[model samples]
Target: MNFESDRIWLYAGEDTITNRGVLVKVKEVLKPRRLRFGWFSKTGWSWLFGSIIGVFLEDFIEGIIKETWLVIVVGIAFGLIFVVWVFWAMNIQTKRYSLIILKRRHEQESFWKRNKDKIIVALIASLISGILGVGGTLLIQLLTKM
Candidate 1:
């Protein structure tokens, strides 16, 4: 086997999510600055939407689903979904990274068997931070604005 061929290349490519920033085709986009920026952008938008919904819910609804318990349940469900989604994302990232490694060695495997639990935990942490921080900020803003 050619040793030169057994290498992983990283390059700038077109970003699927954004047109301005160059995509880094690495094993993973593990840069903390980039991840933080993405999280901030995402949370900012969620807060904006949540504030809007909080303000308008009363105006639109005629006392339907007005209980605090219902709202809490909905919020918890949303958090769960977000957590699960992040877990899936982390899994995808790990799989992609493994694939990059495997590709250099000419191995075949679409799914990585290891690191599933770690991914899930990271996802759960992400969910907690995303939901609590964003949701709390939005709730406060909505209360103040309303």
Candidate 2:
């Protein structure tokens, strides 16, 4: 009786293991190392500095409002709502990014390890632009005066 020879499977070296996957894992592991710093650089500094300047601005604006109470009241109400909206929008974006990271972790997919820097830079640029857009518009209005 002639027995059929069993086929042997040959696995390739490191290339078979997916470099993308490895890169993703590496990026994930390195995230926390710079995440806080990145966030501090992105929003923390601006928020802190803005708050300091805002306190003085608020006092100045308060005086103006006291003199024109009716207009000031309306402005304050609108301003408060706008501030809430901005924070809520930021929270939503942050949560979206968090979810993306979680998904990549679960899928074991390459986590943009190669593009982490670019991803962060892009994200930061968008945030800065939003801030500048809002601030610039307000500043222009303030400068124009009635």
Candidate 3:
């Protein structure tokens, strides 16, 4: 196996595990001490569960939107809140596995502890963006009303 410019190449007859040809590109390369297929299996399960929950939640929200007599502003606020809440919940659910994966490579330090400030900044940025998006939507609605 050879790595160049974030790309990995498995030459023919070089890799014993999979003797065929394989090429892959990744953002970064980290040699894992051990392979655990279980992690990937768990990720698949998590994704499936998240998808089901997301779909159910979306349908519930759609029903509420259709059944209620909410104003445009109120609806936009609810939509923004719901989207942020769902994303936050999903992130909380999946972050543990990602931390575990990172810990395997960087066992000397705690991932969250080191990146807490950056995470906070990112969250703040996202909140600002969400607020701006809602504001823009409200502005468009007001303009159309005129």
Q: Model 3 over residues 1-146: C-alpha lDDT tens digits?
A: 55432233546646544443222322232434223332433345556656755655655567576775354445556557656655655554445232124334456567789899999999999999999999999999999999
Model 3's alpha-carbon lDDT is 0.56
TM-score of each: 0.26, 0.25, 0.32
| Top candidate (TM-score) | 3
Model 3 poorest ten-residue lDDT run = 20-29
Q: What lDDT score is found at residue 4 in candidate 3? A: 37
Q: Give the per-residue lDDT of model 1 (tens digit) for 2-119.
A: 1121233444455455533333433233232133333332345556656765675564353345656665565656556556655554554444332123253245443445667788
In candidate 1, residue 118 scores what lDDT?
Answer: 81
Model 2 per-residue lDDT tens digits across residues 38-146: 3333455456656754665665587585787765665566567556655654664355232224443566746597689999999999999999999999999999996
Better of 2 and 3 by TM-score: 3
Off-target runs (Cα >4 Å) in candidate 1 are 1-41, 63-106, 112-146
Query: Mind sharing the TM-score for model 2?
Result: 0.25
User: Which ranges of candidate 2 are over 4 A from the true structure?
Assistant: 1-17, 21-50, 57-66, 69-82, 89-146
Which pairs, if any, clash in model 3?
A: none
